[model samples]
Target: MAETSPIAIICGGGPFPFSVADAALRTGRKVHLMPIEGWADRDRVAAYPHDWVPVGQYGRMVRVARNAGARDIVFIGTLVRPSLKDIRLDWKTIKILPRIYRAFRGGDDHLLRNIGKIFEDDGFRMLGAHEVAPEILAPAGDAGRVRPSAQDIVDAKLGLAVLDAMGPFDVGQAVVVTDNVVLAVEAAEGTDRMLQRIAALRRDGRIKVSAGRGVLVKAAKPTQDRRFDLPSIGPTTIANVKEAGLAGIAVRAGEVIVAEFTAVTEAADTANLFVTGLAPSSPP
Candidate 1:
C-alpha cells in the first residue's frame, strides 16, 4: 500500500539524507536517491536505491529523477559550496552557465532558488523533508528532559527576533545569546563555527561571559526556502552546545529538523543540556 508512493531525494551530505531515507522507508515509501558524489555518505546511501552524480551535473539529476517516476522531489542536508575551479560542467550544464553564474554570485539562496526553478520547470514538485519524514520535525516544546530557564527563554525570544531581522539579508538561521546580549549570529561560517567563536570568547575572557551562561537558538530565516535550508540539529550539535556552555538550545516548532531526535535528546539528558522547540516567528 505505502509502496505506491514514490519520491525522489536529492541529497548533499551528512546524516540527514540517511535519516530521511530511513523514515520514508518505514512508512513504505519508495525512495530514489540522487546523491552528490564525495559529499554524500556512500555506504549509507547505497542501502537505498541511489544514483551518484556530481554536484554540478544538473542535467543528470533531472534525468535520474525523471527515470524514477518522481512527481515530487525533496532536497536535504548540507552542500558545501565548491570552489569554481573544482566544478566539472557538462555540456547541458554549460549551456545554462549564464543563469548558473548569476546564481553563484548571488549567494546560496539565489543558487538554490534557481535550481528549484529548474526542477519546477522540469515538472517535479519540490517537497520539504518534513513532508516525507514528519518524525524528523521538532515538536512543540520541551524537546528534551531539561527545560529552558526563564532567562534562557528570554534569550531564545530575543535570538529569534534578531534572527528574523537578519533573514532578509539572507544572514543566517541561528543566533547565540547571553543574558539578553547577542553573542554570535551564524553566517557563512555555519552553526558549528559560530558556536566555536562563542566558545573561544569564553576562553578569551575578553567578553567576560562565562560558559553555560547563554542560549543557542536556531530557526529558519524569515525568507528561507523551506524545501532546503531547514535548520537541523543533531548529536554533534548537542555536543557543541554542551561544550559551548550554553544553557540550552531552542528551535522553531514544526520547522526544524531534529535529526536523530532520540539520540540527541538522550545525549542532551546526559550533558544536562536543555532542548526546546519554540513557536516559529514571522518576518519583521
Candidate 2:
C-alpha cells in the first residue's frame, strides 16, 4: 500500500491565498483551492499547481477536497458580500440557510463564526492562514528601512486598545489613526475604504491631520477564528497608505498574513512607511 499525500484545502480570497498555496506546495501538501469571486486572481491560482474550484459552489467545494484526499483543510482569503440576490447556492450552503440569513443582519464576527461552525460540522477542520505561511507573519519591531515613530507607537497602542474592546466580538481588524486619535475603525467597508474614511475625517479635521504620525493598525479580533478571515497586509496595503498619506502600519505578530513580502516591503520602503508586527499586550 502507498502512503497518501497530505492535503489541505485552500479557500482563497486574495493574494494571500495564492501565497498560502505556494507554501503548501513547498511542504509537499497538495492544495485544493476554492477561489472567491470578484476578489481572487484565477490565473495566478491556476498556475500554482493546485486543484481549483469556483467561488460559491459550496457542495462541489467539499467534494473536491475529499477527492483530493484532503484531511486537514485550511481557509485563507476575504469573502465579499454573499451574492444573496443572485446566488446559486449549493445544498451545503443551503443547509446553513438559517445562519446565513442571520449573518446578513449580524456583523463580521457573527458571519465568520457561523461559517466556521458549518465547516467544522462538515468534518473539515479549519486552521488560520498563519499556520500554512507563518513566515509572512511579521515579527515584532521593524522590518526594513524604517522604524515606527513616537506617534506611530502611540497610535498603535491606541488602536490595539480599541481592537481589544472589539476583539471578543470580531467586529474589526484595522484602525486608522493619527497622533493618538483614531480616525477610523474598519467595518464591512474594509481597509482601503476605511482609510478613505480616515482621509475624509482628516480633511474635515475630525482627527489629527495625516501629514505625519498617521499609521494603520491592523489586527485580528480577540475572538478571531483562524480559518476564515485573518488580518492581512500586502502591496495593496502599502498603496493605500501612500494614497492616504499615512506614515506607517502595525499588526499583531502571528495573527496577520502578508501576501508578497518583497513587493510589499519594497513599496513600504519607497513610501518611507514603517511596518511593525506586535503581540497582544497579554495573551488572549
Candidate 3:
C-alpha cells in the first residue's frame, strides 16, 4: 500500500513544503521530512509532524528512507542556488556529482534527475509535488474573476510559445509579455523583479509596446519537472502584478502552482487585474 509506505519528504524553504506535509499526513501516511540546512524554513517545518535533517545529507536521507521502509519520496519547497562552498555533500552526492554535472550542468533539474535515478536504481519511487499537494496544482481555465480578454489571450499564446523555446534551456520560469511582445524574460532576477523591470520600462517610455492598459501572462516552462521548484504564484505575485500595471495574469493550465489561491484572487479582484489559467489548446 502506497499510503502505508513511509514517505520521505526532502524539504527546502517556504510554506508550501509544510502544506504538502499536511496533505501527506491527511492521507494517513507516515512522513519523514528532511529539511535543507540553510534554506529550509525550520519554524514552518517544525510545526508539521516530521524528522528534520540538514541539507545535502544524501546518504542520511537514503538511509532514513531505507530504515523506514520507504519506497516513495517527495521533494517540496523552494531551493536556493547554493554555492559549492556551502554544500555538505555526503558520499552518495559526491559519487554522483560528476554524472549530475554531465547531464545538464549544475541546475535543479539536473541534480533532481540524478537523485531520482538514485532512488529508482535502489527500487524506490520519486513522486512529484502534485501527487501529494493536488490542491495547489493549477486547475482548468481561469483561476480568478478576471478572464483573459482578446488581447490577453494573444499575449498568453506568445508567452507560452516563448516559454516552450526557453524552458528546456532552464534559464527561468516566467516571462512578461504584452500584446504578443516579450517585455522581459525572467532570469536570475526572478519573477517579481522581472515584473518590476517591465513596469520601469513603461514608466521610462523606453518601449512603445502596447499590451493594452494592463495584461501580463506568466506561464511555466513545458519541460519543467514538478518535483522541485515548480513555478509558484501567491499574494506577492498578485501584488507585483498590480504594481506592474498588468491587467490580467495567465499561466499554463495545470502547470503553475497557485500557492495562495484565495488571497491571489482576492488581490487580483481588488487590483482589477484579470487572473486566469490558459489551456495549451486555447486560441491566441
| Candidate number with greatest lDDT | 1
Candidate 1 residue runs with Cα over 4 Å from true position: 1-5, 281-284
TM-score of 2: 0.88
lDDT of each: 0.84, 0.74, 0.74
- Candidates sorted on TM-score, descending: 1, 2, 3
> In order, how many clashes per candidate?
1, 1, 3
Tens digit of per-residue lDDT, candidate 1, span 114-159: 8787778778888889878888989878877788888988888898
Q: Return the top candidate by TM-score.
A: 1
Off by over 4 Å in 2: 1-4, 8-10, 49-55, 102-105, 201-210, 282-284
Candidate 2 lDDT tens digits, 213-254: 687988777776666677888888888887777888988877
Across 229-273, the per-residue lDDT of candidate 3 in tens digits comes to 778788888888777777777887777777767878888887778
Select the stronger candidate by lDDT from 1 and 2. 1
Clashing residue pairs in candidate 3, if any? 37-55, 214-247, 215-247
- Over 4 Å off, model 3: 103-107, 207-214
